[model samples]
Target: MTSRVLTCLLLSVLCALPALGARPVPAPAADGMAMLQRVDTARVQGSPSTLRTELDAQQAKAPKDPMPRVYRAFLALPSDESFAEFKALAVVYPENPWPHVGMGLVYVRWGMLKDAAAPLETARKAVPGFAPALWADGLRLQAEGKPAEAEARLREALTKLDIPRFRTDLALLLAGRPGAAAEARALLVRSVKDWPEQPEALQVLSRLAREAGDAKAGAEAGALLVALQPHDREAHRRQADAWLAAGDKAQAVKMLERYATLGGAEPAVLSTWVKLAVELDRPEDEAKALVRLAAATPKDPEPLLRLATLAEAKQDVAATEARLDQAAALAPERADIQVRRARLLLKLERYFESMAAYRAALAAPERPVPEAAEEAAQLTRKLHLPASPAKGTVEQIYDRVSLGLVALYLEHLMEKPELKGNLKVRVDLDPTGKATNVVVLYDSLQDVLITHSAHVAFMDAQYPPGSEPQVYQYVFRPPPR
Candidate 1:
């Protein structure tokens, strides 16, 4: 018999067990049998209210039969009413295995495995090898996390009655155990091949294949699942992930775009799509995903940070600065942001400002990289800033001996007959009068080497203590041509 016909027969076994008494009720008439099939179809389709209405009609048509009442008990909620209905049927048809089967399934539906055991065992003893009893017991064991026992019962039920759900059940039970993925995949593959419309089998097969490192199998199974449930967003995502695992990035991007178009574009998914776009050399696509992600999670700094990195790669300094500023504003305490801002400022040729930014980055509560501290020290030396200051007066700080020291350092870097021009140097001093920074404020001859030498000499020199930063100007002219 076909699986559908067999499924109907199994459901009927749960409803139509033999009644007890000297004169038992006759079997359902052809019309009543058709009505029972309609109720079974409704139950399978998950239309519980329709199933209830059909069962009522079936009961009215065959008033003496207990099957309609038993089926009604399956759909009853609050379960108390269902339990009462089952008990009433058992009382009237004391020898029927179905009433007990109904009670067992009711407890199973309510997730009360312990309470379901006695009734299920009684039903098994009432009619040996009853398919519904075995099926319910198998599921109850599986729910209780006894997969070995559940597997045994489910396999036994399938041997007697090859139900497709039973195969899926056994496959699921096996899949949960380590080292059983291949076995589970084999079962599901056979089941799907036989019942091509089994969505659950296809889904399980996809997961098992993905976990087994068989990307081709996973992608094929996932493709079938998405086709079967076209509007299921998660199905599309799973297929996308499967394609990615298979190293089919183009297909992965296509599937994920479809997911986004269907409104399944969460921040995490969009983030993945962004990475894929970058790998595929598609900057515009990457930016699109980043924009979506930033909008989706307005408070998250990560997406903005990634956008800043992309901007820097394209040499778009202003865009980089703008994005980094936004990210820093969102998470001011983030040391990474501070470090990026410092680096960006240096690239813009704002040396002094960049130095301050670098210093702030180094001192943030979350420690910047040690390399950043090293880079800041390098900037300090290059800018002719004092590494440290010693307290004292102008003479105490820069005596004739100090002036000679500065002149000596400059003579070493000058031309044989030094260029004849007035090189005016301005040194910014700290509160202690030590020159913290020195710049070639005025270079009359515009001699690059002279200006550099003078700045170096000033960086090496020190001045008297002062309450605030003091500027010192010095005029130098070549002695001879």
Candidate 2:
């Protein structure tokens, strides 16, 4: 038999096992049917050898009954020998509906839709309203491109027996038909309600709910599916997506975290987690996701860059620099990384190093930052100031003081242009290159605001470290427009 036939036969045997006992047999064979039900129930709890022994005993007890023989043939199914056994039983039990149903089911499983029709019709004729025959005929008709007839047969079979398989099969058929979604959803809801362990029904319901834009329902179904199959990574991912769609980001993060724990290391998965974490203001979770994303995609510098930003926000300067270094190594031609490093160094008051970083960014082969050239020039001028303790003579320390005043005036004092003045200020430098105090003695403009502002601005200045305190006097004037 073809692989398709084998697969169909396997599914038919497995899915139909429980329904076999529930299917109505003739009144005269009620006792034999009860025994068949017992055998079917025992099949789950007993070993194969034990089941065979019980089947043999049942056959001896009801020698005239063909159900036990049918089950025996079923045990060796999808084989030529099993087909021969079923065919022999059909000939011996010509009046019985079961043997004909068995032959029809075999033909259906084998993909012989045309051959399956005659035997299923024969079984239906022998036992009017036989659900099994109707169900098999429905399948055959569906395969033969006769959906209307197939639907009719399945509906009739459901009338006889409202089992999970019948409901799900009919739901699946209706699910494919346009304008039948409501009915299909209703059937699937009832099927899953009646049989909570039905994974197939839940799977279809989840998909239909998602397609219908009912994210809440989809998430609920996905949650149940995850509970049923906790190890299924796709189920967790689907649940995560559904929860995210439903606007429950916390729950979505939980599901995605579970997926990751289950070895779901996809960059997309990690990226989504990172995004939600950021939106939810969960910095720790964001860091964790970025870490995993960085590890998962070694060549991608984005995660590292993001990590650097996060570290900088948390005031973790060392960690921020480390992440920036790693990202720069990965993307040497990216000017943005160099800009970030320069900014961080500036924050740390490392002007020379910051200037070098800005220059590097300006010279980057790719994505060079044109504005960084101006930033580098500003830092270079500050570094070369004659009064700068690192590069200037002690006499030119007053020039450094003048530079500080000019910068402070442009940044804050310029807001009050009327306050422009020439002031004499005394600045005392400590051994640590820090300005310990500033005393403004005279203001030519005679403005108290300018003198007080000059004192505050000089106090913030830095100079070369001296062995002892050294006081310097400088005269500052507003820059000429």
Candidate 3:
């Protein structure tokens, strides 16, 4: 998708919550857990057959040690069939740290992150400074809405984390830290060199390379990842995306096509391939992909929704509307349904309807992801806007937002260079949209920024050329860390 569409979609998804709640659930007994620890006792003592006998003897007695259940979850993972079973164990033994961790593992499997958070947090709280729980909860927090907390958790996790995958996981989350990507990249380099078959390290390296604006490096890392993990669909898909982003559209098509042949046309990959086809305007290729999507998942609405996204991408307003209407009918409660409807309305210049649809999405009954919903609400606000125009049709809005009147305010400063700052100006205007007066309510927190110049600049900002501005106030500080 284009950056605008992606931004709009992200805005809708991210605004779905007030800081994530997901409180702790009831836990299983640790006494029972201790008893069940005997099963591992046999393993520790290097007795395999005796381990089964011990477990059987124990199961015959209590018939319920949470450890057996947790160990079972650990054994059943990634099969895609054990999610419900693991969930049941987690629900039945909520107090047992094992179940929660197992639940978190299940969440990772499905990429439905919020499910993992509460359990992982419970584990962290239960065993403060526990490496496994700390690392897992740190990753979960990163997935939730608090990056700084995630970083702190990860840092704490690293001090105690001695897992085999420690370096890889640390390298991945490290990329999210400001000014840490260089270090992360170096770490990943060493990790991949030592564990050449580790797809995660290569993937992190690839992403870091992309962030550093070195597409060739990204592509090389991506290609290496796919070579190592040919069966891993995500590696293939990321390689394709990296190739596309690196301006090698042809390579992207080839890689994606290869993945499709391997029964690896994930919704995201299919959507991406379709996007490429649309860009190429190769109707045959596009038609093949659409046909493949329909044949593979006739009951899935995602492909149809993707069709609408493609139409929106082309600015085919009527066609996009029709497609979204169809998709919404198929899956009315799907967030994507309302999101698409909003975007279609926005594309049609029906701002009010667009805003309503976005709001409906926010209020929808289905559990909305915190990040996604927050983003949606923000987008709806940005797109619907207020009843005033920042500029007329001819002039750019930014031009008007920063007017010569602001320069007048700067002149009024009558001082040496003051740090530039931002103050959100609310324009309450007359009927004709002229700003009678601009008020500055909150000064910036930074001494450098909240200086005389900032106050003068915001106070002097003019409304649009022919209209009044709305009245608003801003809380400001230096730019984010």
Query: How many residue pairs collide in each prediction?
Result: 1, 0, 36
Could you estimate the TM-score for every candidate? 0.48, 0.56, 0.32
Per-model CA lDDT versus the true structure: 0.70, 0.72, 0.59
Cα deviation of 136, candidate 2, in Å = 1.8
Q: RMSD of candidate 2 to the true fold?
A: 13.3
Q: In candidate 3, what are the lDDT values of residues 1-481, reduced to their tens digit?
A: 2455345334423432123344433233334333334433344344546655654565467443445434543544543434444455545444446656666766766677877777777766665655666766776777776777877776775666433245666777777778889988977777666555555677779888988999988898889778876676666777888898889887898788777877884666776777888798776577567656755666777667666666767777776787677766766666657876876675565544565566667776663544546655554334333224444432344344444324433443555344444454444455554445444554443332232322223333344456545433333222333
* Residue 461 lDDT, candidate 3, scale 0-100: 38
TM-score of 1: 0.48
Q: Pick the winner on lDDT between candidates 1 and 3.
A: 1
Q: Considering lDDT, which of the candidate structures 2 and 3 is the better prediction for this target?
A: 2
Clashes of 1: 1
* 86 Cα displacement, candidate 2 (Å): 5.0
